[model samples]
Target chain A: MRQDRSSVRTERDEQFHDFVAGRRAALVRTARLLTAGDTHLAEDLVQAALTKLYVSWPAFRRADNPDGYVRRVLVNVLTDERRRVWRRRERPMAQLPEQPGPARDPATGPADDALRQALRDLPPRMRAAVVFRYFHELGVEETADALGCSVGTVKSQTARALDKLRTALRPPGGAAPHGAASHSVVLRQGVSS
Target chain B: MMDLHDRLDQFAGSPAHPDSTQIDADVARGRAALHRRRVTGAVAASATGVAALVAAVAIAAGGIGTGGVGADAGTGTGDRTTANGSVGASADGAGDGRVRLVAYTGAQPKGFTIDTVPDGWFIQTDDNYSLLLAPDRAKNPGPNADPSRDPVYDPQSFVGKIGIMLQSKDAHGVPEGTTVTVGGKDGVLVKSRPAMTPDGSQPPADGDTGWELYVRQPTGIQLIVQFWEGLGLTQDQMIDIGAGVHVHKDAAQGVG
Candidate 1:
């Protein structure tokens, strides 16, 4: 019995290690967008999600979709973290000048900073839906499963999120004569893809 | 016109990957956490087995129903109501009759008691905060509630919650409000916009208002009772809740 338990533990650890090694970068990228480019918070979210994944390794391995399970856990962790009052108290203001200033990598250009700020301004769930649907390129059904919501909710949230992003990123002067038509085409391509 | 879709694609493409060393550290941390959880589970199982064995032996010895210890002892019970109808019944019977203040000896925090809470309100405490009194009508999505749909951090969901936080000294930096006496202790009552969102974003204009009473004990401990105005609780009622607080003089600081 002891030997069996030891072998099982070793196998589980090996599988979890491999999963982490292969997917850590992608998970971190998703976490960054979810946390609005707060690198420290994104790392914490990834660590928490991975730790939870390790705890449930046996069941997760038995499941048909391990990536989906991990995605669900990641979203849940981010949600729970946001609900904590102490964490809320410690969070920096949304419109703080220092945030956009320091996050601007000279190499990445100004557009990246503006996009990050726009994403940051979104409500947590709206932002999560946008990230999972657009950034991760998950189907609406898949995003719904990961978010533990119905497909209808995913569609609605994604639409609203897109609306907000469009309003935030709209050109200062106004939409060009052909901008709306081109934007629609781009949005359709994104949704279809 | 910049396409939002392209912007999001570019945003997602940004590589913020942790270094290999950090990954290794995270793996080690995860392993340690798993080990700790397993040990805790094993310990809990062993304890349960021993307790069952002891109970069996005691029963065989004809010690079945002799009240070894009263689990509810020192836990406050329903009693008389004050003139203001603040607290009257046991916490278990919140809706039985007039509100009854009970001594809260919960694991998270001590030395404070809630006098009056809306019917169907439940209390949860996991930290130094005195208690989180959530409305009964709120759907408890349990631990597995989906972030995308339920959005646990939505401020509207917590519109009626009353949170009591205990701080050792006046470090909260709460802007001073009108001075009021609560439970024979002088306290400052301050009103502010509801708490910011988890990401430090301002709540919508229509969000609930926040009322806080910071009462300083003679022992230098500060007891803060906070509630959202969306619950429609009156100032007198809020004050009465603060006034009904019974702080145990012998309670140690940060015991929670």
Candidate 2:
């Protein structure tokens, strides 16, 4: 019996190590977006989620869609952290700044910093919706499932989030001419994915 | 113009130096957490077994003595209402709503000092944030349980325990109940649903009711002494317990 327990522990640890090696980067990236570029907080969230995952590894191994389970834990940890007064501090810049690319018209959207700031402005769950839908390219239903919310809630939150992002990204001159069209296009892109 | 996806991608730029050591750290932390859970569970189980054994021994020796308990120790479904209309009842045939608050002869925990504890109860878990007074039969989670994560943290372990802690930082609005006094300071004796039931996150299942005594300290921090219905303590006893609770400087201030 003791030998069996030891073998199970070894198998669990080995699998967890492999899971971490294989998926830690993607998880960190998703968490980065969820925390609005706060790389430190993103890392903390991933670490916490990984720890919880490890604790429940026996059950986790038997479960299907392990990635979904991990993502759900990650999002839950972020939201719970958001509720804590001690962790309610401001988010710092993402560790990796945006790379310089072809310049876009300033009137069309906000700069990278502006975009990060806008994402940070959103409520935690709303920010998670935006990240899952846009950044991770998850379908609305998948995002809803990850968020443990209804699909309609995901749609409304994503739409509202996009609206806020669009508003925040809008240039000093006026609303962008294609704002409405862009909104519809974004929703369609999120849904059809 | 770049779409939302494109912009998000650009914003979530690749990490400059993704530390390979993080995986090791994650594993270590995970292992430590797993160990803590196992240790806590084992300790709680051992305590439960010992308590059952002691109870059986006491029953064999005739009966359990309530040395410091109140005089109205009738073994019945003692359900009564306070004059102020707060729900009062008892469970486990302990007593009616009324219970004698005897001097808590146990070791005083940090953050808060209690002059009185309910009969057959002691400070099971204590921290600078809160103090948990648990009955002798409770499966004590030892002193390591975090009160900040109460109700959700080992739900069954905390059931029927009296919790004393400061009001959360974001706690506002006067709780509706009868006004009372504790240690010469104004307090509120409010009846609330048990934050956690044995089943799960559900509150006060099977008509279970709890009590909360919100006593205002001189420093304006309201101390809350919550009584689980299983204790069957009356509001007056709750206030008596609240009166004995003295907050110390070491007590950590609550956050939302």
Candidate 3:
């Protein structure tokens, strides 16, 4: 009995370690976006979610969809954290005016910064829906399931979020010129709404 | 000219590897949590069995004659007792029916107090800024309960929860909710159905409800009381929980 228990523990630990090693980066990136680029907060969210996933590892491993289970846990943690008044009260230093500007990668520019701000401005649930739909490329039903909401909710929230993003990112003179390269990218991405 | 989708894609660009040190620490925490859960489950199981046996013996002895097992069970704290001995049903008139206020002071801001919550619910103060009240059915399952069959850890299992936090500096832009008086102080109350999404749009969930009260205290402390409707708790009961909240200056300062 002791040997069986020891081997089971070792097997569970190995599975958990492998899962975290493989998925931590992706989960952290998603969390960073959810937290609007607060690396520390993003890491905290990811860690908490992983811990929760570990706690329920037995059930999750037996289930047919462990990835979905983990994603749902991440979404739930993000939503709960966002709802906290103290968390809302605490602003990242990047958001402070007196602080130096956020360090931008060479590939990123003023437009990307504006887009990031716009995304951060979105409501928490809408942001999750948008992230799942656009970034993770989950289907509408899948995003709804991840958010524990209905597909209609996902569609409406995504539409409204897209509208807000367009308004926020629009150039000085109306919409981008027809057939502009970026416009083509948007069209190809199928989020032109 | 860039579309929102492209921007999001760029924003979510390649996932960078996380720090190995952090991962190790997190894994350690996970292992610790697993150990704690196992220990807690064992203790809770034994306690439940003992309580059941005691209740059965008392019933056979005709010691607890009336009110069924629930009333008799209420007199015993079972596993729900806190260190402060604030877990029992209230004898005070403030309680409604069997629902008594379970005084809670854990995980709250300094000077924060939730004088009472309904009985028969499990209260958790492990979170930094909230007090979660989950039904007995929702807490970690005991020996007799199979978690595989009865998953209680989901958020929906919670009947009601109260969160108290210090108001942020940039809270002026918050939309004016319904004006009301709580604990002799003026506050704004906002009630929404299907709970407002993070972006402030009402979702399509018709049954879920959320109530929030933002009270500006005389001491420049902004207290927010938020309750999610669950476990058959009415709006009035949620408001009552908010009204009973008391905060003092000394206790309100330096909260995380």
Q: Using TM-score as the measure, which candidate wins?
A: 3
Locate the minimum summed-lDDT window of 10 residues in model 3 chain A.
A86-95
DockQ ranking of the models: 3, 1, 2
Please provide, for model 3 over A1-193, each residue's C-alpha lDDT reduced to its tens digit, 9 standing for 90 to 100. 3464423445667788888878888887788677766555666788778877777888888877777787798888787666443323121121244211124532222235666677677877888888888877788888898999999999999888877776676766666555542332253354322
lDDT string, candidate 2, B20-113, tens digits: 5766666777777787678767977998999798667656664556432333433223455442344454322244435556788878877899
Cα RMSD of all models vs. native, in order, equals 15.6, 12.9, 13.1
Misplaced by over 4 Å in model 3 are: A1-9, A86-111, A173-187, A190-193, B13-15, B60-256
**What are the chain B TM-scores of all models?**
0.45, 0.54, 0.45
Residue B197, candidate 3: alpha-carbon lDDT: 25
Distance from true location, Cα of B195 in model 3, Å: 21
Q: How does each model score on TM-score?
A: 0.55, 0.54, 0.56
Question: Model 2 chain A: which ten-residue window has the lowest total lDDT?
Answer: A85-94
CAPRI band for model 1 = incorrect
Candidate 1: clashing pairs of residues: B78-B90, B87-B99, B87-B100, B88-B99, B88-B100, B89-B100
Candidate 3 iRMS, in Å?
10.3
**Share of real contacts kept by model 2?**
0.25
> Could you tell me the interface RMSD of model 1?
10.5
